[model samples]
Target: MNEYQPQEQLQNATLILILGILSIIGCFCYGVLGIILAIVALILAQKATKTYAQNPEMYLGYQNVKIGKILAIIGLVISVIYMCLVIWLIVTFGMEALQDQELMQQRLEEMMGQ
Candidate 1:
C-alpha cells in the first residue's frame, strides 16, 4: 500500500490560534469578550484535536491547536477571575458604589475601621 503526504495545513488550526490570541488580549475588556472568544476557540480546538488524533499525518497545524488551547484556558481563567471580582465588588459595595463617591468613601472607611 502507498500513502500520500504533502506539505499543507490543517483546517481551523489558524482560526483557533487567532481566537485564542484575541481572547487573551480582550480579557482586559471586563473579560466578557475574552470569555466568549476563549470558549469558542476551545470548542473548535477540541474538534480539531480529535481530527488530528485520528490522522496525525494529515494535519500540519497541531501546534496551533495546542497553543490555542493553552491560551484559551488562560484567558478563560482570567475572565472568570475578573467576573468574580466584579460580582464581589457589586455585592460588597452595592450599585451605589458606582454612582456615589460619598457612599464609596463611607464604605471604604467602614471597611478600614473594621
Candidate 2:
C-alpha cells in the first residue's frame, strides 16, 4: 500500500496577503511606500499562483493570491493619482511654495475662493 502525505499550502501565500493589506495602509504615505509594497505583493502572488496552477493538488492559498492581486492593483492606481496630484501642485505653485505649509494652505484656500 502507498502512503499518503498532505500537500503544503503555497509558499508565501500568507505573506502575500499581509503585503496586500499593508499596501492599502501605506497609501497614506503619499502613495509611495504603498505602491512599492503593493508591487512586491503582486509579484509574489503571481509566482505562487502560477506554481499552484501547474499542479493544483500540490499547493493551496489561491484565495490569498487573488486578494493580493486586487489590492496591488488598487494601490497602484492610488499611487499614480497621488503622484499626479503632487506634480500638479508643484507646477501650479512652484516647489518653494509647496515647501511652506502655510503658503500651501493659503494658496489652496485662494484657489477654492474660501
Candidate 3:
C-alpha cells in the first residue's frame, strides 16, 4: 500500500516575485525605492531557496524563487546605475538646476559648450 502527499508551495515565492517586479518598476523613482525593494526580494528569495533545498520533493515554486532572484539582481544593478547617474547629474549640474527647468537647460548648454 502506498500513500501520496501533496506538495506545499514554497514560502515567500509569490511575494518575492511581486517585489522583484515592483523593484524594476520603482527604479524610475530615483532608484532608491527600487534598490530597497530589490534587496528585500533577494533576502526573501534566499530564504525560500533554503527551504526548497531542505526538501525538494515537499515544496513547489522553486522556479518562482529563482526567477525572482534573477529579477532582483537585475533591478539592483539598474537601480545602482541609475543612482550613480543621478549623483553625477547633481554633481555636474547642481541640485538647484534639477529643480528648475530653465536652470537645467542652461546647465546642459554650458556643459555642452553651447
Q: Each model's TM-score?
A: 0.86, 0.81, 0.93
Please identify which of the two predictions, 1 or 2, would achieve the higher TM-score against the true structure.
Answer: 1
Q: For model 1, which pairs clash?
A: none
Can you write out model 2's per-residue Cα lDDT over 1-109, one digit (the tens) per residue?
A: 9676688888898899889888888877877888899999989988998898898876778888888888888887887788788788789978988889988888888
RMSD (Cα, Å) for all candidates, in order, is: 1.9, 2.7, 1.5
What does candidate 3 score on TM? Answer: 0.93
Report the lDDT tens digits of candidate 3 across residue range 1-114. Answer: 767879999999999999999999989889999999999999999889988888899998999899999999999999999999999999988999999999999888887995
Off by over 4 Å in 1: 99-102
lDDT score at residue 72, model 3, on the 0-100 scale = 94
Query: What number of clashing residue pairs does each candidate have, in the order they appear?
Result: 0, 0, 0
| Residue range with the least summed lDDT across 10 consecutive positions in model 3 | 1-10
For model 1, what is the C-alpha lDDT against the true structure? 0.90
lDDT of model 3 at position 46: 89
